[model samples]
Target: MKKDNANASLQARKEAATPRGVGVMAPFFVARAENSELWDVEGRRFIDFAGGIAVLNTGHRHPRVVEAVRAQLDAFTHTAYQIVPYESYVALAERLNQLVPGPHPKKTTFFSTGAEAVENAVKIARYATGRGGVIAFTGAFHGRTMMGMALTGKVVPYKTGFGPFPGEVFHVPFPMPLHGVRVEDSLKALQYLFKADIDPKRVAAIIIEPVQGEGGFYVAPPELMRELRKVCDEHGILLIADEIQTGFGRTGKWFAMEHHDVAPDLMTMAKSLAGGFPLSAVTGRADVMDAPAPGGLGGTYAGSPMAIAAAHAVLDVMKEEKLVERANRLGGELRERLLALKARVPQMAEVRGLGAMLAVEFCKPGSDTPDPDFTQKVRARAMDRGLMLLTCGVYGNVIRFLFPLTIPDAHFAEALSILEASFAE
Candidate 1:
């Protein structure tokens, strides 16, 4: 095989072998990846600003995380935590119970993916409150599972063609002041749902992402969070913070929910939880978590020893490296750069996010119309210049930056330069 045609050949093979629904962005296939860089099979180096969709806060193959997984490989791989419990699982759960926000006693359960954690969270909420209805905000992305689809607001790509989702799931507009959706409007919609749609008493949980991920990097208003907590208290609904993309120090804090004054009743976490390993968890009030009977929750790979070891190493790396603080510093610098560039790049409608989880929305220069085409051009130009990027938003006009917190100073600066160049005519 010619080295020059490696990517093209792989692309052909991928199209033939894989389902089209997977939706891969890059045209090249990766040969290897380090902290903030990866080389394609054709020996092309690209600075990774996507961070594997927010799963590499500790960066690719961090020495400690790799070593921890290797150590676990020698001991034992799988015993099925349900069948034979392990000390590591319990210890990690204990750590989370303490680390997760909230003054009340908490309990945690492990899962293999964010979707699994979300599904289990709803189950726990329903069992705890004895309700079947759930409310999710428009533009919020929970996951890709059936129930996740039902809970998610966006229809294209994720929920398209796959219909007949789980019933009793409802959606209200998420407040995006830029898009004319206000905090008051969202609360009123919730009230309308209670009066017209489902009874508040029948609602199990109200799930949200403190910072919307796929629907663009819109931050949830503090006022909205406070009101939701009050509504949950008034009724018997559980408040679930979906922190899958914003967890593990992506948002300058351990979790995005920390940005709010009020704490959620339940929280779903994944992505960077295990420093790129497959691990997710649901942590909530001890009483609420205990609502489900034993044996009711637990997957074959729910709490694999390998992932547990990776998670422990991830936690250690976060604390020792002070990643949470790094997030704020890095985010501040990037925010400043993007803001300064806005005057030159008229299409840059807004730059928003919490901490390092930032995004720049593109729109028509004079009007509020979304410019997905302009957004794509920015992504394409960046890719051509050897910088990888990711886009989100219902209109596909937002460029989100998910570079690893562990990215080297030189690499990050180079990527930023490439990003600024991407806006040039």
Candidate 2:
């Protein structure tokens, strides 16, 4: 047997073996990765600003996470929590229940992916309220599943040919002042939706990302949140916070919802929850979570023992290393740098997001026209200089930074340099 350890070969194989729907951003194949850095099969090193799409808050293969998984590996891997439950799963649920917001008691259930968490959150909301309608915001991204796609707002790549999506799912504009959408506009739209589209009483949940993830890193306005909570209370509609991308200290707090005053009835979290392990959870008001029947919830691989163990270690590492505070510090520094760069880069339209979950939108110089081409150029230049970056937004004109919270200080500074050079070139 011969080992063909080349990125070109692997990329060719991947293209031939995989479908076109699964987009590949980087042309290189990863050979190894560590905290904030990865080497390609060609042995080229690149600073991982992508962070596995915001999954590696603890960085790749953190020693603590690795050790915990190793220990769990020796004991057992999977027993199907719904069949033979494990203590670690229960313990993790307990931890999440306490960590999630709201003064009332909470309950939690685990899933394998963020999409699964979103799907189950919807199920729980409908069961609890006995309603079938759901409201999501435009430019929002829930997931790739049928139900996830239905709840998602953007339609190009995520919903182009996948419909007919699940019925009774509605969408309203999300507030983006730069894009001319205001909070009042959003509220008025929601009001009109209730009047013209679906009755408020028939809506089960109003799901939103505290910081819109794939829709571009726009922070949900606090006023909007307060209004949503008020409306939910007024009409028995449950407010579901999709914290999958903004949870586990990526946003400087345990969850982005913490940055707001009101608490949601339910919250879906994943990505960084298990330090790169496949674990997602939905924590909500105890009664709301309990609405689903005993056998009504769960997955075959939900709450795997290994992922549960890794999640425990992720929590420990977060506390011991103080990653939450680190997020604020790093995010502040990045924000300052980007703001300074914005003065020089006329195409840089706006900088937004909370904590370390930051993004910069690109537009035609001195104009509102989205410049996705400039955004692509910046990403390409950064990749050429040994840095990885991600682009988002409905128009694909935004550059999102998702560096690991545990990134080494020196590496972080180097990535910043690469970023500045990318924009300059």
Candidate 3:
């Protein structure tokens, strides 16, 4: 691959080989990445605010994570945990069981993606409670799998032409004060769901993202979470927190659920769990996890040894670097900058999120209508200036900031400046 032809040739080949359904956000292909920076094949450097779609919260190729994966590769990679189990897998599970926000006796299971963890969590919930229905909030993005797509709330790209999704899965409104859907409105919708849709007795679980990930970084109000807990307890429904994007130090905590006093019955985690390696987990009450028989769960590469090793190293890196505190500090700085920009850029309607998992929403000036066109222009302008940004939300008017918690101070400032310039453009 010659320097001049690097990106163009590769992109042409990719178009020929890959299906269009698999979206490509960036036109340039990555040659390498370290911490919060990426180098394209053409050698153009980019400050990565997308963070590989929130999967590199510890940053790309953290020394500890790389060292751990290298060591695991030297020994072995996969053993199929259900067939030939490894100690590291069990150790990782134990660590998660202890760290996840519940005092009740808990157990953990590993998978390969956030969607897998969600599907397994739903399976476990149904098996434990012997129910056929599950509930999810509007504006949630579980994954692309059948169950995940069914649970996801957005329609255009995620659910368009992809359904007939799974049956017995329902969606209720999520609280969005900016959009006029208040906590009371969301709670009342749940009540209406029980009355007009599925019976409470037949509903097994209610899954929600602590901060809406793909739906624009709308933080779930703590009060709404407490109310959900109360409702779940009242109806004997299991509450599952989909923390795939909000876990690790992205939200200044090990998990977003820690932000609230209430703890969920089951939690799905992934994305940053194994750094860049693929890994996901579902942790919950011991009794509930045990509801499925020994042969009833697991996949071919459910707990790959390399990913387990990476996950252990990720935990160590979080503690040693104090990335949780860094998330809080960085998030505050970023929010302050965005708020200042919002004052000048009338399209900047809101800046909201928890910790470092922040987002900026754009709307038409003097109106609440979403300004997706302006949002895309900002993203494109930022990319042209070597800053990679990601857009989300059902309206496509949000620019989410998922820069690594380990991002250097200098790079953070540079990225912020680039963002401001993009908005100005």
Candidate 4:
């Protein structure tokens, strides 16, 4: 493929071969990526702030992760964990059980994707509680699988024509103060849900994202989390933290749940677990996890040796390099820049997030109406200026910044400059 035509040619072929359901954010195709930089097939060097949709907290190809996967490749690759278990899988599980928040005894199981982890977590919760109903918040993005999609609150693209989804799943409002939804309002909604829809005794779990990922980077207020914990305890319903996007130090902590005083009964994690390798997990109370009998939860590729090796390295890199502290430092700097820019950019409505998982929302000048068009323009302008950005939120007016926690100071500065220019444009 010639350098000049590589991107366009591949795009054309992609259009012919792939379905529109799999959305493509950028027109250009990537050839290589390292840390926070990506080189497109056309040889364009761009600062990557999207971080592969928050899957590279350790960065594109950390040497440690690469070396670990390479070593695993030299050995035998696949032996279904159920058919023939591996020591690495058990070790990773042990590490997670110890690392995840909560002092209670915990156990873990692995899967291939975030959706699988979530789906299985629900299964475990239901089996443990002997209930059939689950409660999710509005604007939540659990996943796209049947149960996941059913649990998710957004509709347009994710749930449109995809349902009728699984039954007995309910949604209550999530507090978004910027949008006029208050914590009290959300709490009331949950109360009303129990009274008007599903009975508390029939509810198995209440799953929520620490920071809403696809619903926009809205941080779940600690008060609301604590309230939810109380509600779960009152009703004997399990609390499941959907940390697929907030784990692995994206939120400046090993797990986002650590930010709150209460701990989840079950937690789903993925995205940055293996530094881009496909792996996910559900870690929770030992008794709850063991509710599912043997042979109930294993997948053929649940704990691929290569992904397990890469995950071990990811954990090591995070600890050795202090990426958790780096995430806090980077997030502070980025939020400060965006807040400062808001003074000049009238459309900059709000800048909110936790740790390095930050976002900037846009609205029509002097009004609360969301400005998705302006958001799109900003993203396009940033791309033209060689900075990869991602737009999210229910209104599509929020620009999320998921740059690798490992992004260098110089490259981070350059990306910020490009972002400022994009806002100006």
The 10 consecutive residues of candidate 4 with the worst lDDT sum are 156-165
For each candidate in turn, the TM-score is 0.99, 0.99, 0.99, 0.99
Which candidate gets the maximum lDDT versus the true structure? 1
TM-score of 3: 0.99
Query: What is the C-alpha local distance difference test score of each model?
Result: 0.95, 0.94, 0.93, 0.94
lDDT of 1 by residue, 72-188 (tens): 999999999999999999999999999999999999999999999999999999999999999999998989999999999999989999999999999999998888999999999
Model 4, span 279-397: residue lDDT tens: 99999999999999888897999989999999999999999999999999999999999999988999999999988989999999998899999999999999999999999988999
- Candidate 1, residue 326: the lDDT equals 96
Considering only N, C-alpha and C atoms within 3 Å, which residue pairs clash in candidate 2? Answer: none
Candidate 1 vs candidate 3, lDDT winner: 1
Residues 269-357, candidate 3, lDDT per residue (tens digit)?
A: 99999999999999999989999988888999897899999999999999999999999999999999999887779999988999898
Q: Which stretches of candidate 2 lie over 4 Å from their true place?
A: 1-5
Q: What clash pairs does model 1 have?
A: none
Tens digit per residue, CA lDDT, model 2, 253-310: 9999999999999999989999889999999999999988889999999988999999
Alpha-carbon RMSD to native, per candidate? 0.7, 1.2, 0.8, 0.8
**Clash count (model 4, backbone only):** 0
Instruction: Please give the lDDT score at residue 89 for candidate 1.
Output: 100
Per-residue lDDT for 71 in model 3? 96
